[model samples]
Target: MFDVEFVVDIINKSGSSVEVKLDDQAKKFSQIGLDSLDMFNVFIELQDATGKEFSDDIVENLVSISTIVEFLNS
Candidate 1:
């Protein structure tokens, strides 16, 4: 099962909130305050927690918590 709490914990560790606004949600990776390194760490944490490997394309497409939840569920 997808651990939503684990995802949230990773995100929070980056000093960002899950309650992002809709407009902010549509922003690109660079504008979202999460650098490439942050993403790499998140991916590592996710893989460790979920035992699932996420590709670069999939990581790029994950815009929101709900989307992540769906990804994990799928």
Candidate 2:
């Protein structure tokens, strides 16, 4: 059920200063101005929203909305 729009919504609501959009799906988190803490919060929010947990290995590669959507659907 996870999609780019869903991911973008969560990212935007995760308290990050930067606002993410569907066009930014291929962009890196850092390129969008998301710091470590922002990413941490995003992940936590994502886990809570999706009712799914990510392992360290998976989290390491989740650097973009495209990847996150792929991982979540996989």
Candidate 3:
């Protein structure tokens, strides 16, 4: 299951918040306040937590927390 709390915790640990709902808007990497380094960190954390590798294409196209949840769930 894709728990929101788990995701939020990761975001918080990355020194950010998932409080903003990206559900309505198209979420881009830059829009989420994740720079290239942050993006790498996030990917690393996600992989560590879920044992799933997020591809560069997905990283570039991410648009929301929901999208991330979907990716992790997959």
Which one is best on TM-score? 2
Per-model clash counts, in order, read 0, 0, 1
RMSD of each: 4.4, 0.8, 3.4
Q: Model 3, 11-67: lDDT tens per residue?
A: 657644333342423466567665677667767887788888678787776555667
Give the lDDT of residue 65 in candidate 1: 55
RMSD of 2: 0.8
lDDT of candidate 2 over 2-67, digit per residue (tens): 889999999999999898889999999999888889999999999999988988988999998999
Model 1, range 2-67, lDDT digits (tens) per residue? 555656666656544233343443455456666777667666777877788899789877765556
- Comparing 2 with 3 on lDDT, the higher-scoring candidate is 2
TM-score of 1: 0.61
Tell me the lDDT of candidate 3: 0.65
Clashing pairs in 3: 27-63
Ranking of candidates on lDDT, top first: 2, 3, 1
Q: Residue 44 in model 3: shift from native, Å?
A: 0.4
